[model samples]
Target chain A: MELYHRIQIQDVVRLDHAALDAVEAGFRALGQGRVVQPPILSMAIEESNGEVDVKTAHIRGHDRFAIKVSPGFFDNPSLGLPSLNGLMIVFSAKTGLVEAVLFDEGYLTDIRTALAGAIAAKHLSRHDSRRATVIGAGVQAELQIAALKLVRDIDTVDVWARDTDRANAYAERIRERFEGLTVNVHGDMASACREADVIITTTPSKSPLLDAGHLPAGVHVTAMGSDSPEKRELEVSVMTCADVFVADTRAQSESNGELKAWAGKTMPFEVQELGPVIASGQSPRTGHDQITVCDLTGTGVQDTAIASFALKRLVA
Target chain B: MELYHRIQIQDVVRLDHAALDAVEAGFRALGQGRVVQPPILSMAIEESNGEVDVKTAHIRGHDRFAIKVSPGFFDNPSLGLPSLNGLMIVFSAKTGLVEAVLFDEGYLTDIRTALAGAIAAKHLSRHDSRRATVIGAGVQAELQIAALKLVRDIDTVDVWARDTDRANAYAERIRERFEGLTVNVHGDMASACREADVIITTTPSKSPLLDAGHLPAGVHVTAMGSDSPEKRELEVSVMTCADVFVADTRAQSESNGELKAWAGKTMPFEVQELGPVIASGQSPRTGHDQITVCDLTGTGVQDTAIASFALKRLVA
Candidate 1:
């Protein structure tokens, strides 16, 4: 007889700094070549306007690993339901017995993705970075800024969205949460990114929204959206102008992220991975005058890491 | 908020003929090209002697689909644990929200795999088939024979295993459950298969155990054991000698089943899929003197079908 536990979304929403640290360690492990992360298995259900992706990774020597089933039904919002929902199945690596199912309903994905943005900024941004600009005013737009505050002393935020009302509402939400922090709604992408020390793109845009001319010198950018082949956020020139161009994984970047703009051509600059950057103590930014860009298409290591972390918290 | 239900292994063991019919319908749907099943996602944990495979499929017009996590840790039996363990996570096709989690401990897999063997025999074997021979006296060996009775009036059974005592024990168990059926334990594979009208192979052997010479004319063979690249139960000549060759899926058979013996080469006969054959009502064996071989590598449609069926039963 085996025992199986169910950890729900409410239980997962209480994730703290420890959960972020666990995800960071997963990246470090991957960078050190101690993780076996396979290519994602994706299937589209055209009839229901939905798609499902299965991701899993094993961190060497870990007691447990996780296989996450992430499904996105784009039409769910019309049915009075959330668009994204799924869970993580965690198993004991030693015996292959299922330990728990984290029915987080995509909450863990949101947490880990936000944490990845923070991890990128911790290594790439300058210590004095304060001002931030966020493209898109969705759940990720708000979460990315909140996550960034973990590493940088973010005091002011500029938000740009195609919908002005949503952008203003996003600003108001941020203002209520962070006391003394100034939030501004920008009408254009260029104006929003002009004076920012860090810029985060969190849109599901099908075309490039930010180009090389939009970036201020020394500003670090984290493109958190564009996780599918048909979506891209940064222009190709934006990548060419950056001093450091990092990806969560090179293969994913080529097929699903901003690097898809490269069109199978070799990049002019050396490409770095977030895992290696975190594992090694080397900062790609040597001076305050160099631009940096991080492309996050997401990875399986983050899912397993966050799931393992959530299960420990729930059980404890 | 979304609700998730956990249906345990004990709850799943109550599968009956209706559940088997549900799985059979799944195969029919796949055969008719109404299912969208993606390639399997497999990851190996070599250090722990375990491997995990994720399988899912969306059957057209169905309200829900299933993503099954199957992990096999060969060393678990020594630890007083079953070597196979995992569950199926079912989601609503319209919203992609998790409908339920069936922590069935691989009971559903067993039920479906056993039904698949019976399905093949029903479509390919002679209607008057009354004698059955099973190679390897394992759980599947017993289940396959029991499931076969749903299709044929099996009155006698011959079983062969590496260990004769285990074979005798299997015979006794069958005798107790299936009253009026004569069961025999055979020491040699050839003798066990000689006088049988239906032959089912259920072993984890890494080499060929049955050849063309062992298969008598007019006998229908259901090779259910070889589901990995390293395992092969039927010799290539056995396939060549068959009047018709059917696979659960051509792609899986080429990689993991006895069809791997063909080594990327085309077979002399047209290879049919079991689903289409069932859907079309086409019997590959017209006369009682022709041999038919059905290779069972398992499929995602079966998992989704059985999971959906089990959920309906549990909820009701």
Candidate 2:
């Protein structure tokens, strides 16, 4: 089997129009019930304070699919190594032969995840939106803004992080990359999101950081972190108050994202998945003053979609 | 990072004592409650008449773990390709970094599976055994006999299959391989198993093939092929009649093995996993006339164990 390194993959996969469309198509297939996705196969290695997740999906009729293996060793940063590293194995959906081994090392995941946030904003946020308030100053915090630009004319970013230095550093780097774009570092999350058209939570915070009072009117919020049972970025009131509550997948949202606060209780209102909502082509955001929230804990279909897209570009 | 092809893996891994012991140690860890194994993540591609299974386990304190991806495209044989092909990814338990990739293409799984049957017989079968009966003239039917030789003094074989020519062919091959061993191709299932000291059912039959009447006194029956919901090889009476009933893992067995026969209902006897039996250093087969049965549904720890062992030999 052919093995492609991170450099090769980085050259091919991007948080651009084609990649976003590919991922959106995956959600469309998933919404149409043409995708075969199993529950995430997760293993915890307590001795190392690490976790690994194996995810796969087969979009019916698609010629190719992908299985993603992602590992996160939290202690790696302490050892001067990156905390997350992994790869994707793309395969022929018809014959099960491997198409390629993409040692992208989680690059595709980062792109796909950021794109998912953009997807939610595209369908739920106001069309004339121009500013994004990003929580956390990580790689995702930067990529989320870049991806949001594909769907909306985003030219400004408000950054908030627990670490002021990291937030300021993020502002400097993003401003350099996105020329002439406005960048502001906020000391408080409420102020960061006070006048934003869209809000994105990209922190690994284990407590609720964003709530109804912090959300601006007509703002579309994408909580892209909080993918574990212990992590929660949005308070229950935020979900309860949103005019449109979207989950990437309800099962995953309930298990890992903002919806965990209402895990067993009956939902106060109808909750729709981002897939079916996008597939319907009818925006749930019918009014400009609506609060839209999407809990994107991530899904296997995104991995499969991004990997398939990566292979197409690499082979081309 | 290092990808080892089938030949490279074959050169290092074998169905021998060390390999068997490694696999056994995995089960020992499992039985000792020192292993973290999740349920198999399975996906089916109906368009291709194919299925894929992803399995992995973390043996606490072990330096490494393995995630195995196995694919079976049943229609491949119709296209003149082998029906099974896949690989294993071995990672560092400490840092979650890629150590090696075993592109064994299901070779390691075959060895680990066959060795699991041998492990069962070694712990549950009578020690003073010489003759054997293996139903189904498939790859496993042949490997079971070769693996059985590691723990028993097998000198005679009784084979039964739906295909007469294939059964006769298997008889010819094992005769040449075992060198002067008596080989008998039986016309019926009952007679094939009547006088055997060890009776192994290795077919993908959706219905039961072995029953109480077919089991000889002191015979140890290892049903190794029923690893799916619709597959069964032994009748309920056979399990009830056996002095001890064993499963590789009760959860897997309940979902995809002989234990599926009693999936919802409680079994008539105490069912133990082969691992605990080995770890305890006590055979449930106390009497020579005792009929012991083991359901070998396979496990993630076996894959982790075998792949870790394979890497050790390759790096050496």
Candidate 3:
């Protein structure tokens, strides 16, 4: 009899960069029509002020499993706990049996999202880009940097946060983690936004954070946050300035952020899907100074891709 | 961090009779709106002649969680293995934390289903009933026997199967495990159907196994096998003769067995839900000779109820 293995979140904590790399490959595999991802079902708990989602997918020639319990951890600070919890189960399609369970829900989410950034940047970011600015010095902030490094030869990283101490700490961590990479702790948000070849925002704020006027020409901004309707990370003016705007899903992005603000209005740009860009090589690295922005709303395909990839790595 | 423990299937076997009690309590809890079970989703693999389903449920007042897996064990007989496989997970609604992982997918499915029979019999079975004829002695056949014992005082059980050896083996096992019960093996299906005050069928066949004309008066038949559209345990004539026909869900029954046959035509009878019957004291138990049939197309509510109850039992 084949036994189903249950893995706890406490069992695997440090599945960081290596896991993200595997997840990136999964996305590519998904684009190749090698995976089947069902629509993600999200349950937003208003009373608890949090949300949880269950994502299912069938990775053809890879894995058939669903990622359950990707619940947003809220009350972590007050409860003295991490801000995310849950498990992912890999079930076999051959026998319709749950083969393994992984407990690192938050870490998995982090890596998958970061891998998405890496994928977007690999196709979208300029080849000569060396500096990147990251807003929101939180858990996701560090991951964005890690993912960016895998795509571009990034040397200098500008970090900004509401809490200067946290930003400084994040900068220190980046310096220690990435040897010979200069970590610049910016005092002002606008200063962090300007003169960077690439920029990523990973904040949970409802209003815009960066000043649009501060952005240099030809900058590639990846809005890594702003997942729901209430979230808007990029300034409304940034939407107008962006030469080409790309999104993980046009529907999801249109309801959230600057896209929501610009929706139904006459905008000079066209919304391109991430999958098509990856599929047709449409997301090309243009000239040295072409402005680009990718608004990622996080699709079910990413979950399917990551799950399919992880299962293969585990079994192999 | 709260950790969900895993109970491997090998650690526990013969979870048949054990689940009937829990299933009964779960039904009561379900009527109380303390459980939330979505409808069961399935996909039939036509080429392989197999089916896969993802069964999920959320039980209220016990920390919300859904049990998910593609459980397919119908192919086990051909593979020389148990045909059922899947995983049961209990997750927290408040924190989105997975609390427990039970690896006995098909075992739990069988147990909960049999328990539903026991629950149905507890309210619908004949009083002073001392005999039961199980139509098909497959996996759930023995469980139905155990479940009946909890609700009715049965002194003898007549077992019938397509294969005589399988029927004899089932009868001997029941006799060994359950005290105060005599096992009688039937030469044919009608012999068992002729004497039974309560009839139970647990086959995966598409055609009717027993004759409606052979059924004795006042017998309560619990049809456990016909859940899918292509499967059934009773003939259309038998349903027409039933005085009271109760089902888990009227909508689901219409798509499955007896109802599927009676589609576009008036229902054999106006169906009553199990919830209202259990909540109200109006369940008719006038005598030991009322021909009542409760066709159970297993609901997601049952899964939620049992999963919640099991979690409580584990914690306590």
How does the DockQ of candidate 3 come out?
0.25
**Candidate 3 CAPRI classification by DockQ:** acceptable
State candidate 1's DockQ.
0.76
TM-score-better candidate, 2 vs 3: 2
Would you list the C-alpha lDDT of every candidate in the order shown? 0.89, 0.92, 0.71
Order of candidates by TM-score, top first? 2, 1, 3
Query: Best candidate per lDDT, number?
Result: 2
Poorest 10 consecutive residues of model 3 chain B by lDDT? B1-10
Per-residue lDDT of model 1, residues A105-196, tens digit only: 88888989999999999999887999999999999998898889988999999999999999999999999989999998998998999999
Q: Which lDDT value does model 3 have at A203?
A: 89
Chain B TM-score in candidate 1, rounded to 2 decimals? 0.96
Identify the superior model by TM-score, candidate 1 or candidate 3.
Answer: 1
The regions of model 1 sitting more than 4 angstroms off are A1-16, A263-268, B1-15
| DockQ measured for candidate 2 | 0.91
Query: Model 1 chain A: which ten-residue window has the lowest total lDDT?
Result: A1-10
What's model 2's TM-score?
A: 0.99
DockQ, per-model, please?
0.76, 0.91, 0.25
Candidate number achieving the greatest TM-score relative to the actual structure: 2
> Rank by lDDT, descending?
2, 1, 3
